[model samples]
Target: MARPRRIVLLRHGESVGNVDDTVYEREPDHALALTAKGRSQAEDAGRALRAVFDGERISAYVSPYRRTHQTFQSLGLDPAKVRVREEPRLREQDWGNWQDRDDVRRQKAYRDAYGHFFYRFAQGESGADVYDRVGAFLESLWRSFEDPHHPPNVLIVTHGLTMRLFCMRWFHWTVAEFESLSNPDNAEWRTLLLGPDGRYSLDRPFDRWCEPESYGVTG
Candidate 1:
């Protein structure tokens, strides 16, 4: 039987990492709060989403990170209407042992070895690592949808790597193809529609400016 429809996805308005890029970050990493620009970006994202969904019920979930929580706060979603649940599985890739490294030589060497995030750092997890975790998360989410009362519209806030990996599976993109997707900007969300037939489709990312008139959805 076709399952009930649902929407699950990442949050908007958080930077790639802590500004001190030289640091070798560890799991439960350092703070990477959204900039002022990021907050504005998130607001716009919220506006766009509200326009699309209108009065549809939304079940919202967020990673246990300050940036993600703050992003939603900026959106001004009512706490009563949108219950925020935190999940560690939704957290960023734990970049262990790669924190606080001021050594340009080592950093450059590591970057070269990994080829732009292909390598698992000394104490860090790999993209594949995150993919595994998120995969399980998705599986559990689907199980809940099996319930007749599950909400039709859902939202999730997560990091770039996680989003990339999850979307890769949905779109049937290879590693290279997934890597080719634009790195989502802070406060830019990607929306997906999951059909009862178990098919996933991309809606739009938060960073992209979307006009209601453009989509012809009149409020």
Candidate 2:
């Protein structure tokens, strides 16, 4: 195949941080484990994906985080039919280091006030930073397409922010559009289906935290 027929972007399931941000103080963000409900959610998403795929071969790229790895494993795709790689570029936006829950909350408020796209964490990356890397990763993805035997279906197991940024870059969305869309639910995945003309289209629109038309006007 040249370009994949479908690109599946998935957010990792609920992790310790999802239920309790305080875990960051003691546990590294990359090491956070998924909760029981998260496992169930991933399993359910897996079943749904398998049904859509009907046992087709997949080329999978997963984030390096523990939770993402766990999510990919829970997807239950047949290993013999899937070629998977641990993609560091798909990792969650760096938060600098271990965090204090209260401080993180305060920073998040600041981020929202300042604007989500450009707002940088105290010692971490802004949304645009993640976009750059995801764009770079796309180059690699396209390069793989040069091989005639490349799988027709692509799967990405990653964090919410990265997943969103991947789409923004791929679809050439503006900063305002990026800010308007909310993150996907844990274990949720979006399908980007290839059109007859070779362009990709998302199966559904994302829920917005803010109105899309509000951006890019000056007084």
Candidate 3:
């Protein structure tokens, strides 16, 4: 019999800094808080996920970022059922010098960094760093599967870049492939299946959105 494992990648809702676009890494990281719109988004995301596995057993993991944490709360999950494990590996790619740039400038910088995610920050992290951290976290999660009681669905709430990397790694995506898979919206869930022997297979393609017209399709 194949041991079953499904890891669900969830990106956190919008944040105030995300909207204003002035938030480069804050001194104490106060900029990471969720904005009103983000809160609403989180609530919707939570309810949507809850409905998917309404009565099914599930476990959750979260990045330490405030936005990601708040997103999890909005979902209405029972506290006991949701385990708040802080996986730094799941943190967003450090924008470094570009953290506090205005919207236009930020967009340019972001585009430049789009595919070369492995690029490092002056005092922060790169896409490669995020991938390494998530890799470690996934290893730990795999260990948890050793216990027969491990839940069937494990939800992970994290940042946009990190979530992208998670999807890329699980899909065995190359550099070009990773760039093609990036997107900003939440509400859409990326699913992956892990067999008992420890190899992963794609149960569903990366883009399973009910409404794909909103975001143009990517190969």
Per TM-score, the best of the predicted structures is 2
Per-candidate clash tally: 18, 0, 2
Global CA lDDT computed for model 1: 0.65
Alpha-carbon runs more than 4 Å astray in model 3: 1-5, 25-31, 97-99, 102-114, 193-219
Instruction: Arrange candidates, best lDDT first.
Output: 2, 3, 1
Model 2 clashing residue pairs (backbone):
none
Q: What is the Cα-based TM-score of model 2? A: 0.96
On lDDT, the stronger of 1 and 2 is 2
Please list the C-alpha lDDT of all candidates, in the order they appear.
Answer: 0.65, 0.91, 0.68
lDDT of 1 by residue, 90-109 (tens): 78877564465555347547
- Give the clashing residue pairs of candidate 3, or none: 24-99, 46-75
lDDT of 3: 0.68
Ten-residue stretch with the least lDDT total in model 2? 210-219
Per-candidate TM-scores read 0.76, 0.96, 0.78
